[model samples]
Target: MSYVLAGDVGGTKTVLCLYQVADDNSVGGSMEEIYKAVYPSAGHERFSDLITAFLAEVTQRPERACFGIAGPIQDQCCTATNLPWVIDARQLAEEFGFADVYLLNDLEATAHGMLHLSADEFVELNPQAMPQAGHAAVIAAGTGLGQAIMAWDGQRHIVMPTEGGHCDFGPNTRQEDALLLFLRERFGGHVSGERILAGDGFGNLYDFLRTSGFAAPNPAIEAEMANEDRNAVISHHGLAGDDPLCTEAMRLFVRIYGSEAGNLALKCLPRGGIYIGGGIGPKIRAALESGVFMQGFLDKGRMARAIEHVPVRLSLNPEAPLLGAAHMALLRSQG
Candidate 1:
């Protein structure tokens, strides 16, 4: 059996997969989930080192490899936005003795993965609209915000990467207007959408609420946060409806998230749909369904109805990037 290696290289974790694509040119056949593993991205100093460890686990060298990385791909190389690693497809191929290697923006990989996913893999957020015929968009908020679009040419999905997450954040309410100023002063210049929509952004919002006197912190939460993951702690308290400050932070976060999601829809006019992927979406699904996200999304005045027709859904498959990378490896192998 010919093996295809795929890697989903993200800010927090890196997942590597080895898939057995049949020699008969069948890619997505059943019983093809070979081996997969996850490693902390930050804990490793070099991506090559991580690959080396993973390669040792395999019985033999893979014929082809592809990596979906969390940054822009240029000249066969990528410097991950949230990590200090620089990945070069050529270097990887040379070092690993592979005939070819491919690199893609993580969201681009996600879009590819979306094509292979079954209907059961997704959780619908807006079931009112049908999956319209046109372009489709994917927006994920994990360590960073990643955006991509898929062109449906009446046949297959052609995925494209974008740096839209770095755009200026437009606030929808007075409290958010104050949030922009607060973030601007601290971030020291422009506050991008990723600044307030990502994992660290949750902590930033919680801190802002505490400092702005809008909500006071609990001693227990402060103590727990001293050791536990701050974002997780805040999200836990917020979603449980226990802490007022935490709930308010979640509200603001949902608001900003929806606004950005809507902005992406407006720009791309993704009539096909909008898929919300990433670590954060599934974690805060309750908060998202609390009407804040859709409210901020539909608050776009005259353009509201158009985006409303854009189906919103969540990608529950965490291995989507890996699956996408494997698909890319299959596609590259065909050529």
Candidate 2:
């Protein structure tokens, strides 16, 4: 069987997959896979070591490879956004002795894989409408907020990456303004959407709420999160309905997340739809479906009518980026 190696390289962990491409132009199946391998991207300083390890572990040798990198791709090389690792495609090609190699923005890869997702793979937060074939947007909140747009270029979908999450956060109300002030004092200067929307951002927001007197602390959730990482503990407490502070933080998070998504929809004109991807969205499925997200999304003043028609879906598949990398490798091979 013909196999292609695909990887989703993240800040904390890397996922690698060996996939078979089918005749119908879809990834047939994954023969081998690795999930959540801990690699110290700093100090180690090379993607080659990780690649070598993956190659040694897999049973089959792939003919081609594609990677979804966590940072900008310029001239076939990249420096990871949060890590100190530098990835050189030419060096990787030399090391792996592969004829084909492709690098893409991580969010772009996720957008490409969205084309193949079935209804069962996603939880529809807003069932009020469905997607049309036109423009679409994918926004993810993980270690960082990643954003991308997909437009139908007459025949097929073309994914475009954006640094939009880095754009300045616009306050919607007095409460948000106060939150911004609190964050500015802590972080200094401008605050981006990523500052309040990602994994670390959850804690930041929670801290802001606590310090700003927006919510009172619930000792149980606070203690659990204080011992562990804040996001997971906060989410657990919020979902369990055990803590009022956790609940409020979650509500605010969903609102901000939805507002940003709506802003993205407006900018991209995603008639095809808006897809919510990344680690956070999937875990808070219940909160997103509880009208908080949709309310924020449709709360736009005059343009609300336009956004109301757009369908929104939460990507349930965690392997989307890997699958997309394989799909890109297949496309490149065919060309």
RMSD of each: 1.9, 2.4
lDDT (Cα, tens digit) per residue for candidate 2, span 150-175:
98887788998889899988778788
Best by lDDT: 1
User: Candidates' lDDT values, in order?
Assistant: 0.86, 0.82
TM-score of each: 0.94, 0.92
- What lDDT, from 0 to 1, does candidate 1 have? 0.86
Q: Kindly provide the TM-score of model 2 when superposed on the true structure, using C-alpha atoms.
A: 0.92
The residue-by-residue lDDT of candidate 1 on 49-97, one tens digit each, is 9889998997866888999998889998999977899899999889989
RMSD value for candidate 2:
2.4
lDDT of 2: 0.82
Worst 10 residues of 2 by lDDT: 27-36
Clashes in candidate 1: how many? 0
Per-residue lDDT, model 1, residue 74, is: 96
